[model samples]
Target: MAQDIITIFHGPQHPGITGNMSVELDLLGETIKRAETHVGYLHRGFEKMIERRTVLQAFTIVCRICVPEPDPNEENFARGVEELMGLEVPEKAKWLRTMVLEMARLQAQMLWFAGQGGSLGHYISPQWAVADRDLILDLFEELTGGRVYHMYITPGGVRRDLPEGFLGRLGHFLDYLESRLPEYDNMLLRNPVFLERARGVGIIDPATAREYGVVGPNLRACGFMNDIRKDEPYEMYGEVDFIVPTETSGDVYGRAMVRRAEIEQSISILRQIIRRMPAEKEIMAVLPKNHRKWEVPKGDTLVKTESARGEYSYYMVGDGTDKLRRVQVKGPSAVHAITLLEEMLVDSQLSDVAMIMNSLGTNPPEIER
Candidate 1:
């Protein structure tokens, strides 16, 4: 006799889900037999929207591509436009952009910690991680006037220069964040309960990771030394010093550990930026005198940035017009949240669904966009 197969949706409303996305699962005795990804709950049609707007107008909307980590979208958009226009960004602006990217990465990892812990019924991790993450948000709010979506990075460079004594405040926060790392390790990384649930589960074969278009920490977790920052240095990444951490296990715990190590790396990068940043007052490049009728040269260029989740890219075209001829985004979530996720869910227990999703750093808005 064959067992009855049960069909169910894992979310668009469930707390365990990473975002406004659902996975349809065909299950038998709590083990997933098949999985299908469903998106469109959040914002959509971002590429179309960008194509219809002017360069400046389009800049405002790219940040909406990924809510948790918007800076990468902004960076990609800015760099793509800059390349098309042949604009040279100032040295100071480059360091500022790099700092913002690293700050974004740090906060995003904290959010991941919250999701990873919450999915496994470890409530303490969320509370502690969120509280610590808020410190970075506070710095963002001070720097960019927005906590979540910072529309700070622009076409040629950053929107403005840093405020007075801002680096001093940032340095202090970095110290605080570094000091709290041990506490995070004790509560989550070293906790026996977390180890039992995470170890050896949701393992991704290193050989298959690349074939599935895996990037960022997920790829690194599988022992690949791939990182956009190192491979293709942008902004001030070429000037900074950092290592791409990796793990051979390719499991939930290995992914978690990679992120843990990256938090320290982000801190180190920020410290280097703070020390070596050029002392220049000019942050923005000169734009056309007429803002409403600004036109770029006829050309297209591709730009990529290493976001918190993975590699984010923008392909932009200009036909000598005020509006862009085309704008296309290739975010990591499109692959990770849909195809890779569906494949990983098969034959896995239902309870581990959210844990697996969170480990991949799945974000639905990126998928929908």
Candidate 2:
């Protein structure tokens, strides 16, 4: 029997679709037979835009490209520029950078938790998850003066060192979050609605994940032990001790469980960074008076960091000029586009389309740019 193929566009602004990009889905009844992704709905000239701006100016703009997770871009850009300048970042700054990146990870995961739960039709869970996340953002507001897009981490070092008794306050917040993990378990993790909705949904197998170059929690959920923190160990990660969570299921539920456990790991990492961090940390470096013409020796550097979604890479090419010759960003959305969303949608119900795609944490802006 020849099934009728129905074409449906997922979203350009649909909250369920993650970011503002549409997907061309060919469906037979409720089953999606094929998916073609479109990305230009967002700002299309990100690379060209960066080349026009100064190195420091460009840093502020990079985060907007990938909203849900932005720190990795800051990290990669700062790291790339730093490598170009042969700048020696203070040990304290390195630990602090590691802490900041993980905090962003925790926040991104919080948002991911909410979005994933919502996608699977467990609406109440997102409320609880977002509520918990607001507290984390509150911490961000106090620390960086900005909750969502924190331009705290600059080229030389952070914008400023930890605030007065920042450690104690942060410690208290961490304690609060740590204590609330049990509630998340009761409310979302072990809740009947979530389990029923996510148990076997959006399943991505291990071999398929590896072949597609999946990274971070999604890949980890599929039983791959690939982690930039463990594998590369940048920003004082080598100094801390933490366990990378792994799951064998590779389903929606598996990723959820992995995310839940990973929160504990993030908390663990932050605590270690605080404990081992030096008291006299320099927030910024003394640079040349002329900020505009801040040129460094000629060199190109490729810096890759694992974000909430997966491995985010930045390729910085320099011609010994104040402005970067080229800055290229590579994110996990490609795999999400070609491998997961396209293949996973086939045979999946129309309703599950949003749920499945969002659960994968596909940020369209990353791919669109």
lDDT of 2 at 124: 75
Per-residue lDDT over 20-92 for candidate 1, one digit per residue giving the tens place of the 0 to 100 score: 8889999999999999998899867888888788889989999998888889999998998889888999888
In candidate 2, residue 264 scores what lDDT? 94
- How far out, in Å, is residue 144 in model 1? 1.1
Q: Clashing residue pairs in candidate 1, if any?
A: none
Tens digit of lDDT per residue, candidate 2, span 148-236? 89887778778766778877877888998899889878877798877887788888878888887888788999988889989997878
Which residues of candidate 2, in runs, are more than 4 Å off?
Answer: 1-3
* Cα deviation of 66, candidate 1, in Å: 0.4
State in Å the error of residue 58, model 1.
1.1
- Model 1 lDDT, full chain set: 0.90
**What's each prediction's TM-score?**
0.98, 0.95
